[model samples]
Target: MLKKLGQFTLSILVVSLYSNITSFANNKPLTEAEFKATKLPYSVMAYSNKYAHEYGLDASKAIKLPKGLEAIKLTLSKSFSKGYGPYASKWDYNCTAELYVDKSLNLYWPGDHAKVDKVDDRGLQKSQISTAQLEKKGKYWVPGPYASMLYDAYDKTVKADLASVKLSFFGCGYIPSRYTAAKDGLAIWLEKKGGYNYAVIGQGEREISSKDFYVFKLPQNLVNSYLPYARMAAN
Candidate 1:
């Protein structure tokens, strides 16, 4: 009985010691003072602060953010068909914010939509065209589960970080859909806040046919869909 008890105590001691060592080594716990001192981009810090204060997430509960942005992506989405346009049966609107680690990280917005149910036996809006018909329009359009991710015809590029030329995306004439303010892909848009700039290597249209990201024409109403994860270049 004595031996067994002694062995048990020894085991417990070893385990406790090991655990303590592991904890200390595994996680270099940051002090509260150190945490506060962490430096971030001016724009990112400001944006993140607002998001955390207004919404409940850690500054990044929403998706669809600005490109080259380093804070939480706060967004709101309301369809035009609510009481005015169409698709009034089952409607949804969302408010979201997506967070990122830092300025170096790039975000990819995941898009997978729903079925376009036809109102009558004859059809729904614009009559759902088969993939074959849609494909011929351009190489950018893919058969998406929901609304297809927008793409551009011919590629384009720009300097977002320029001191004079502010990164531009989205306006009235270039609606993503006829419904949207941009006719190009959503993932390609960017804006240069303050003086900092973001450089684009490739775009969302296709597999590196060209190195271009679209400048989306964002309107006041559809700004909710613009969620960009900070993409950092890999070292």
Candidate 2:
């Protein structure tokens, strides 16, 4: 009789402990409200380094980046490479160029050429950024050749208090050549200050095949709030 009673007591204690643990887990949130308050700036590194880092390699190469901007590189899918250019190589996979204005910016991996999605409140919209408008410079395409197209589109499309903006270039797939080709790249513009705090120019969709110009805008207050945390992470 005593043995049975002790067993019942132990079972009751186990059930009580489990209930408390479950309650604690259910109440906890993924991230604290303070952490969500701000956005961080992202870093820029060479394509080779970023690729090597992803595969657990010791990447030591450093690529010079423009002022107030960081570099981003992406690799193309095997199937995409095989279909686009017969001479495509493993190195050719690292064709896309990425630049981040904020060093603490979050890292995102949206296969090949993904499209940007629409968001609310922060004043983000899709602009008509076509490859046809970009200028061909030697082997690569440059936005400097077609600044007017972007400015005109901004004036016609963006309805907000404009303050400051920056533009960068991105390549989608590998093209067979001594250097990156003009047609293989696209232009991206980001708005640093204005009605919105964070804005980016890239593809409108997040799919691997989509490649076009897109503008993303966010609130300045939201980004500023997270600056401290972002700085810590960068260091």
Candidate 3:
């Protein structure tokens, strides 16, 4: 009986350790003090501070978006209607932010859908087009238009400039929907005269695409303002 009890305790310890490791792997945001301690480069630090200040980050709680920012509603193509369970597919679409500066900053909240839905006579849902379903099946549903718009807006606004900064925000599990439990984060794309650089904050650093993208992991508290929309959909 003593040996069996020891084995059970060992199993509990293993499970607890695994949970902690998984939590760490998900990449929580850094605290403001921790962020400062990192002593990131001036440009990166400055941009991050600006974003936090503008969005009003307070201990990673509720965030207040800036007033008067234009709202852009995103719509999915008609192909994602079927094969998606009702709970798996419902998302919020009204929380995006846009600004038209020398370059543009466009931020889409989580729960944005990538495809449209229509109900058939038999009460079954179907995508308007066959290709839309195929695209989702292939997991090719990342917001391509939004990304292109970011590039084009920056390109147009910073004509002849050496570089420019553009921001994009996503809640956990929104983009690349496969990672439903991903952390909320933001990306800053630096459009240089000859090349492009991307930095992500509030999540781990990794390459998001074949393009010259880079991720800078920061504490999720820094981006709490945009997380509610995603969280609502997730619930």
Candidate 4:
């Protein structure tokens, strides 16, 4: 899988640096046989070693961040949320991204038909955000290429009955002051199958044991430094 990904990225590099290549999605999905015949375009966000050490998340350096980016906001599936379900990855879906802040639903437009919760004015008047989360409507975003690619791949390759997801993030980190250690990831309810399976690759990667969210104890300084690479890659 890594070899294939490398080839795809090289193809993408050629297109990005030289000419315009169109349409990653094709009538017939990519096949190994066809791919072997010719390299195709694919770009991935690469993170730096210095940046990886800064985050203190030595999971997979292969998950590259866009270049020169500080940090990118992202919306993830429930599979990775705290209190995860049967099909979620205990690893990627971690406490670092959960909406854990205690927030009271104060109000919502559209009568909250989707069960959208609004924070009570009294709740969390203002705080500092250290982690990333998903954005609802009226939210602007500038994610890196991989986020879109992952979403597309999930929609195409994964057979599980995943729900319609419309999430966006900003390439430059935002100034929102809400806690996300509880609300994001799969634990908050998204997939009907109630589980998440990685699309491909990442075999034998190490994962922390599922305990309380935030078990990794990511410090603010580390996050701040590493976030840039994540932003650039995901932007």
* Top candidate, metric TM-score: 3
The window of 10 residues in a row where model 1 has the poorest summed lDDT is 6-15
Q: How much lDDT does each candidate structure score?
A: 0.22, 0.25, 0.23, 0.23
**Model 3 TM-score relative to the real fold:** 0.25
Writing each residue's lDDT as its tens digit, candidate 4 over 1-235 gives: 3332211211001112111222232112334443334322222222334434543433343233222221222222213335455665442311122111111212111222332223222111011132234332333321111111111111111112111111222222332212232222111111112122222256213221112111112223223323322332232
Error of 1 at 80 (Å): 29
Best by lDDT: 2
State how far residue 208 of model 2 sits from its true place (Å).
28
Candidate 3 residue spans exceeding 4 A from truth: 1-192, 196-219, 231-235
RMSD of 4: 20.1
Q: What is the C-alpha lDDT profile of model 3 across 1-235, one tens digit per residue?
A: 3222111101000111111111222344445454334321111011122233333422232222222121111111112323354456543322222222222323221123221122122110100000111112233221121122122112122232111222322322343322333343442222222222233344323222312222122223322322332333333
Better candidate by TM-score, 1 or 3: 3
lDDT of 1 at 59: 32
- Residue range 1-235, candidate 2, lDDT tens digits: 3222111111000111111111121212223453343222221123223323443433453333333322332111112334355564332211222233333322222221222322122234322222333455565443322221111111111112111122221222111111323333233334322222113455433321112222322111211222223222222
Off by over 4 Å in 4: 1-98, 103-111, 114-168, 173-222
TM values, all candidates: 0.20, 0.23, 0.25, 0.18
